[model samples]
Target: MTEPRASAFITRNVLFALVGGGLGGILFMFFLIEFDHFTSTNQFCTTCHSMTFAETSYQQSVHYNSPSGVRASCGDCHVSEGIIMATYDHAVGIKDLFKQLFGADYNDPVINLLHLPDAAFASRDWFRRRDSATCRRCHLQEAIQGTRVHTAAIHQEETDGKSCVDCHFNLVHRPVPERSTFKREAWNAMVEQEFGLEPGSAEQLLAAGRRPAGERPPAAAAPAHGVGNGQQQAGLEP
Candidate 1:
């Protein structure tokens, strides 16, 4: 009788231990996931001084403010939507943290790119490859209304595989310039020289009409009707 009671007591304790441990593990995992989500917020992204320029530009972007009252944050654009892709992004972010700490100077474009060519290229490539799936998350075709004919045409054309960033690369953050070398007027002049017409000008509209059948303007040259056409068209901003 004594031996049976002892054995029963031991079994009960073992069961309690297993159940308690399982609950504790689950609680810990929940907190960890919540913490990760918190860190992905816009506020957390601007915590680093390296993001100062990006944050400044984002504040003025359509993603930050629009008539519809819907807003997208840093994570919406930068982080992947799927669980697997987001996990991979977090892993890559860890490596980027190390690089930012020791290898690159965020304020010095030349030195930063020189020291982190791979990182720079990787970022550009990621933008080129992502196909604007992140943007589509909110701007789905069914949900979007009042799309301009030109904008609709561009969306249809992208079925050939061009990503959104290919055209809208400067929508949020202009390319960081070399130290003390960025000038808006000079940049505008360079653009006008390359594209044969100033953006949003009458000449640009005429040039668009005259542009050869198969030739596409450089991506930096905003299309006459697509994502870069400023605020006139609806359902184009992301």
Candidate 2:
């Protein structure tokens, strides 16, 4: 009788354990599904504190509203497709959240890139390095048959390792004028530096230090040539 009672008690405990474990697992799965759904939405992304400028630009972009009535949201372009990529993105998002919470001047770089002169090349570089996988997912090459020469040329040029953002950097957003002037100033600085003239005094220095065409300066005179040229092309101040 005692043996039977012990067996009954063990069975009861096992049943309770199974029920509790099953419920916990179900709750966890439900939470994950809800979290994923929430994060996938454009509203969640645009509402984040760091997204003010980006949100404004997105609203003004053709992607927001076009003749075809199609719209692409922030997640459509910024988030990688697939569960693994999404999980990795979320992990990065957590890190960014922590930075926003604790780091001083967390949004300084974003502000500088949007408004300051000679400080936005890093942002441009970031755009340049992105893979066109997401863009291609929506704008498939096979579906892009058109008679427009420029459009066709741009599509064909993708074969040369150029991403869609290369030519269409400002497609969804108007670039800051200061950023454009920064590029020109940076170029002039490179020319000045190559001729051993003062930086930022490009026009005056280049004029006074002008060397004849095909007349290469002494190699020692331009020790920083490579560095200057890289800064010029990248629109970065040296």
Candidate 3:
């Protein structure tokens, strides 16, 4: 009797473990929805104190404070709404989270190309394509029906089955110039140094240095005949 009870207990434990494992796998498969739900919450966005800057800026942005009273949360634009799309989004999020948690210089520069995972970047473009598709699914009739400014800007030929996000991107997500403003200023300073001019002197030089060709410095005339400015024999001069 004791042996039978022990055997049954072991079997029950194994079954429970198997069931739990299966459920975990299912949740993993649909991780995007879970991630979207997490990010949708105000707590998630504001959890990091450093993110206060982004939160404040977003609040004041035209999207949040629009005259039409269309208030959208951070996740509305940044996340996919549909279940499957959200799952896909979650997969991408997992990779991004990995980079953020384990990356060498994570959060140091906040936006460094070198630190980005290739998979995450590619997945981002993929997400944009998906979002464009989502937009068209609902807006196809409207697109065909009317004359919005976008219709003119986006020729049918240009769309060619590509996502609108391919051409249109959020200002926040736009690529930073490969060179920084400081780098541009530094380059200009170097150019001025090369020309033996200071930064402020350029305006003065352009303002006062102008002279007609007639008023320009004359070329030294050929030494009057052969008596080359006293270099020739003194007797050669009349």
TM-score of each: 0.57, 0.54, 0.44
Residues 1-238 of candidate 3 have per-residue lDDT tens digits of 3345666666877988989999998988677556668876656865653344345545666656778786666566555767776666656667656654654332221122122223234635665666555445434633453356666545554666666555543333222222212233332333234343457543333334332344322222211112222211122222
lDDT of 2: 0.55
- Candidate lDDT scores, in order, read 0.55, 0.55, 0.46
Better of 2 and 3 by TM-score: 2
Displacement of the residue 231 alpha carbon in candidate 2, Å:
18
Residue pairs that clash (backbone atoms under 3 angstroms), model 1: none
**Model 2 C-alpha lDDT per residue in residues 33-78, reported as the tens digit of each score:** 6776688788887566445545565677788877699898766766
Q: What is the lDDT of residue 212 in candidate 2?
A: 38
lDDT of 1 by residue, 52-98 (tens): 54566577777777779988888887888865677677777887677
lDDT of 3 at 214: 43
Write out the backbone clash pairs for model 2.
none
What TM-score should be assigned to candidate 3? Answer: 0.44
